[model samples]
Target: MESETKQSVYHSATYHAAGEAIMSFKPINEIHQHLCAFHVYSSDHSRHVEAHHYCKHLSKDFHQCVIYDSDDPNARLIGIEYIVSEKIFKSLPPEEKKFWHSHKYEVESGLLQLAPKSLVPGAATDIAEQPAMLELHQTYGKTIHTWAIDVYPDLPLGPPNLMMSYIGDGQGPPAEMVQARDAASGQDTAAKRELRKGYLSSYERVEAADEWAKTGRGVEFVVKEVPLKK
Candidate 1:
């Protein structure tokens, strides 16, 4: 029997229905300590429970609070996400700090493809005209990185705009793909895949949701304390 607790679902291509529960996290600071010990974050317990649930899925805790600081104190809780697990935090490579920037550009460009046929025909045409090398680098760079990681299970690579279009394609031709190509070429046979573990200490200015479009804090992130729900 289905448990009384409502289960959240994430969209995936492999399944006709929901894929899995969305992962979440919370802070590991005083507020979290208070809540676990006292069932409150210096604010109303009911309001922030949902937000807490969201982060709890990611196996972290909320630090300050976003719920109580809003103009309407009684509003359902929201908070700036801080304090991720060491596993996720370390995933942000010091050398690859610019990854998010490149990824942002790549994602934005891909989204443009969804516009009407008349929109930016020149841009699309340029992409279509670009040499095979440029297209491969731009399209499959992230996939290569993802695949190189042993910690993550294999992932599918297809149209960037649609991440869920295919699966079981993780083992394809190496000449046409970086991950497969690297594995096949055997240039770095001894190069062990990096283990991914760590939290994302970066702050995204807007309230984050499950959509891919919601990443990246527009400008330099200003530290802000998210209060608990009232």
Candidate 2:
């Protein structure tokens, strides 16, 4: 789904570096976490998209991420995801809650993880990553992918699709899908599944969120017709 840049003249890169030196990237500079996960379209569960989330904490209760199809330098910007704490999510109207999905299954299942797997189990990096993963387990996320890169490889087409996280056993992506990520990132989702059982054992799902898990259907957008101004 990714390819080397075929056309370039280095002019843009030169100006980009110049801007970096003269201008301060205040907001984006705060990006502190790199997370990688799989997102399936809410409207069609069959479409699985691998996402790399470069995120920042906007406030105590909220986080936002810019998603990319790959970690490569020229990775295409595919979507955006917003994560809100349970306190924030609990206040939303029932209809609004239908669009957000829980992070518990993704966290515990190891379908979601901080980027760069630990070379050694329980190393400093692993210790640092554990709490972040646990915190995410309690939050809810709403993701939308503007680029249908998996199908329309050359260009993004169609409306932005609301994305959802996996929640149940046997609902995860296929073996080959998992294999591709593990091969690239040195991760073991199966091992992570067993490792997290002890920490996440006491976790409980919130009834007001992840409406898709309760109802078999998901939220999506469709073209609507109306009279234009005359």
User: lDDT per prediction?
Assistant: 0.23, 0.84
Cα-lDDT of candidate 1: 0.23
lDDT of 2 at 194: 81
lDDT for each residue of candidate 1 in 116-219, tens digit (9 for 90 to 100): 12224333533432332132112211111112111222442321110110111221112233333223223221121110001112223211211222432222
For model 2, how does the per-residue alpha-carbon lDDT over 163-217 read when each residue is reduced to its tens digit? 9888887876877989899878776778887878867756776776667666778
Runs of candidate 2 with Cα error greater than 4 angstroms are 1-12, 117-124, 225-230
Least accurate 10 contiguous residues by lDDT in model 2: 1-10
Q: After superposing candidate 1, which stretches have Cα over 4 Å from the reference?
A: 1-57, 60-66, 70-79, 95-230
| Candidate with the greatest lDDT versus the true structure | 2
What's the C-alpha lDDT at position 112 in model 1?
Answer: 11
